[model samples]
Target: MAEITTEDGVQIDLVSGERMKKLRSMEKIRLILDGVRDGNIVILEEGLSPDEESKLIEVTMTEISPDEFAGIEIESYPQQEPNPGFFSRLFGHNPPNKLTVIGPANRIETLHKDKNLIRALVT
Candidate 1:
C-alpha cells in the first residue's frame, strides 16, 4: 500500500485491486467525496489515468475547507481489512481512517486551491 498526504495534511492510504475498481469509477467519485467529507480515506487500486487523477486532485483540493488539512497516500497493492458483522456492515459502515492513492508521482503534489475548479471537476 502507498501513502500520501493531502493539502489538508490528513494522512491517507491507497490499495489497488478489483475491489477498488468500483471506488475509482467516475460515477462513484461523488460517493468517494462524501466518504472523504466524513474523514474516510480513499483507496484506489488500479490507479487513475492522468486526466482522472488531475480531476480528483483538483476536486479534492477545492472541496476541502481552508481550515481542514488532509493528506493522501498511494500504495501499489495493499492488504484488505477484515469484514464487519452483519449489523455493523449494514448500519454502521465506516470509512478507513487512512487515505491512499496509487498513481503517478508528478501529479500527486499539484494541488489546486480553487473552489470553482474543484466544483467543476467533482460535479
Candidate 2:
C-alpha cells in the first residue's frame, strides 16, 4: 500500500500489477503521462517492458509543452532472480515484476537507483 499524499501534500499514485495487467501498453503509458502532467508521482508495481518504455518516451517527446507540461522522469530496475531451477535455466522462465517510478521531470529528481532501491526527491 502507498500513501496518497506526503506531508507537503504532493500527490502519489501507487498502481498495482493487477490493475496494470488489465490495461493495454498504450493505455498504461497514457495513465502515467497524465498523472505526471497533473503533478502527481506515479509508482508502478510492475515496470514496463523495454518496448513499452521506449513508446512512453516517444509519446512524451511529442506532448512536451514548455509552459504547461514538462516531460517525465522515470526510473526502474531489471527483474532479479537469485536462483534458477532446471526448468527455468533450460526454458527461460519469466522473472518477477519490477518496480517503476514516474513523475514530472521538473518536480521529481532521482537521487539514487540500484537493483533493489530507488531514492527520489519530489518537490
Candidate 3:
C-alpha cells in the first residue's frame, strides 16, 4: 500500500452520486470541507449540491492566502454545473462532476510529470 496525501500528490475521493444528492445540504458542505482540509482535491464522481457549491466558494476564499493562492491553483466543478440540457434537467441526470484538482500551485503544475497522480486522479 502507498500513502496518500496532498504532499504526496493530488489526493482524490470518489463520492457516490446518488447518495450525495440524497444527503442534507449541510452534510454535503461538511464533507467537502473535510476533504479540503485533509488536502485531498476531492474528485466528486458526482456533481455537487447547490449549497455545497456555495460553501466551497466561501471556504476557498477564506482558507487560502493570496500568496498561497498564487502557488496553489484550485479547480472545482460544482456538483451543479451551468445550464444543463433538457434531459439532464428533466431526468435530474448530470455527469459526475469528476476531478476537482486543488493543491499547491507548483505541485499541481507538476501533475503532468507525475503519471501516478494523474492515474489516480483520472481513474
Each model's RMSD to truth, in Å?
14.8, 3.3, 7.1
Output the worst ten-in-a-row residue range by lDDT, candidate 2.
88-97
The CA root-mean-square deviation of candidate 3, after full C-alpha superposition on the true structure, stands at 7.1
Clashes of 3: 4
TM-score of each: 0.37, 0.83, 0.47
Clashing pairs in 2: none
Q: Model 3, which residues run further than 4 Å from truth?
A: 1-7, 65-123
Candidate 2 residues lying further than 4 Å off, grouped into runs, are 1-3, 6-8, 81-97
lDDT of 3: 0.53
Best by TM-score: 2
Ranking 1 against 2 by lDDT, winner: 2
Mark the 10 consecutive residues where model 1 has the least summed lDDT: 114-123
Lowest summed-lDDT stretch of 10 residues in model 3?
114-123
Q: After superposition, how far is residue 84 of candidate 2 from its true place, in Å?
A: 8.2
**What ordering of candidates by TM-score runs from best to worst?**
2, 3, 1
Q: Assess each prediction's global lDDT (C-alpha) against the native.
A: 0.46, 0.87, 0.53
